[model samples]
Target chain A: MTRVVARVIVTPKPVVNDPQGITVKQGLATLGFREVEDVRVGKYIEVSMEAESMHEARERVDAMCRQLLANHIIEDFHFEVDQVLHRDTHR
Target chain B: MTRVVARVIVTPKPVVNDPQGITVKQGLATLGFREVEDVRVGKYIEVSMEAESMHEARERVDAMCRQLLANHIIEDFHFEVDQVLHRDTHR
Candidate 1:
């Protein structure tokens, strides 16, 4: 089996209100970072899996993201799948 | 002024206990994703800023991450800074 690592990023839809992002933007302003604008907060998920190939790994990770990693109603998810070397395997 | 977008990813240190990750891993197992392993949860933050140059923008975002976006004690943060096109500006 091939060991693969998937980095998934889940972000709120543009129309959705991101209270956390707003709070952070305000915090930045308070810190004298007035130049900062349009801050968006999201979730980053890393999944390591054993698959037959990179294609299979990507498909499985995509399914995982859609099923649990992200709420499709308000969030959009994207991911990158890469084969892991023996030295890079966490387990 | 240059419009730049910074994507920051924050993950817990390897030594830190991530309850969220453990929970997710359990969920995956229950869902019959036995091939999955070492699931980690983290935060992804995107910040758009106006600066004089790309170098300045990167420095500012790095400061922002260090000051408020990430807790250095238990987390490690990395970011990618890129120039934003006119059409990509959120505001």
Candidate 2:
């Protein structure tokens, strides 16, 4: 099996209300950061999985995101999958 | 001024408690994501700053993290600073 890394970014769609993100942006502005713009808050999850191939890993990671990591009603998730060397199989 | 980007990853120190991360890990396991391990949850803040230089940008980003983005009592933050092409100066 090959070790794969999936980096998932879960964010509320643009149309959706994100008070948390808005609040953060406002806070930045209050802190004298006027040049800052387009602040959107999201979840970043990095999952390392052992799968036979990239396709299988992507499918499994997608399932994991749908079932656990993200709420489809308010959030959308995007991921990038990469193969990594298995430095420590014993751990 | 130059436009710079800072990617900050904030996570609880290893010795600190992370109940939320632990709960999420358990949830993933319950969903049959058996390969998942060592789940650490944190905030990823991407800041776009217009500063006189890279050193100034880093200082401002560091201050932002200390004042608002991170709770130093429980979390540690690491950031990567980059320069991005400004395609829309008007916007």
Candidate 3:
């Protein structure tokens, strides 16, 4: 089994009120930033795992999110899984 | 000026207790995931901005963080600024 990295982002739905996100966006606008938009705030999860394939890695991460990483009633989560390349050090 | 993307991740220092991260890590282990470790929880900020240079873009984002994106007393933040690639369509 090889190491895999999963980056999970959890955010509120568009219809849901994101007070934290809004607060951050408003703050940005105050700092002379005019072009910022859709400033949604979310969580990032970095997990190193050993999985045989990308599909399996994703499945494992999906289960992790549903069970604990995110509060399903009010939030949604998405993740990207990739294999970790270990560099060989023999020259 | 070109568009820039900033991905900011804010997390508590390692010495600080991270209940959310610990909970997720434990949950993963329970589901037969043994290789996961140091699962830190953070935030991702995707900002589309027009900046003249990387230094200027970073300066703007740093100001944003100090003003709002992260709480200075409880959390520390790090960000990556990259020029956004916009594909022009002409046939």
Clashes found in each candidate (C-alpha, N, C closer than 3 A): 0, 0, 0
Interface RMSD of predicted model 3 = 2.5
Candidate 2 chain A worst ten-residue window by lDDT = A82-91
| Per-model i-RMS | 0.6, 2.1, 2.5
Candidate 2 local lDDT, A3-42, one digit each (tens):
8778787878767887777798799899887877656677
**Candidate 2: tens digits of C-alpha lDDT, residues B13-75:** 767877777887788888898887656667777676688888988988898889998999988
Residue pairs clashing, model 1: none
DockQ of each: 0.87, 0.48, 0.45
Window of ten residues with lowest summed lDDT in model 1 chain A: A82-91
> Per-residue lDDT of B32-53 in model 3, one digit per residue for the tens?
6776764778787666567888
TM for candidate 1 is 0.95
- Output the lDDT of residue B88, model 2: 60
What are the RMSDs of all candidates, in order?
1.9, 3.7, 5.4
The global Cα lDDT (0 to 1) of model 1 is 0.90
Which is the leading candidate under lDDT? 1
Give the fraction of reference interface contacts each candidate recovers.
Answer: 0.83, 0.47, 0.66
Native A-B contact fraction in model 1 = 0.83
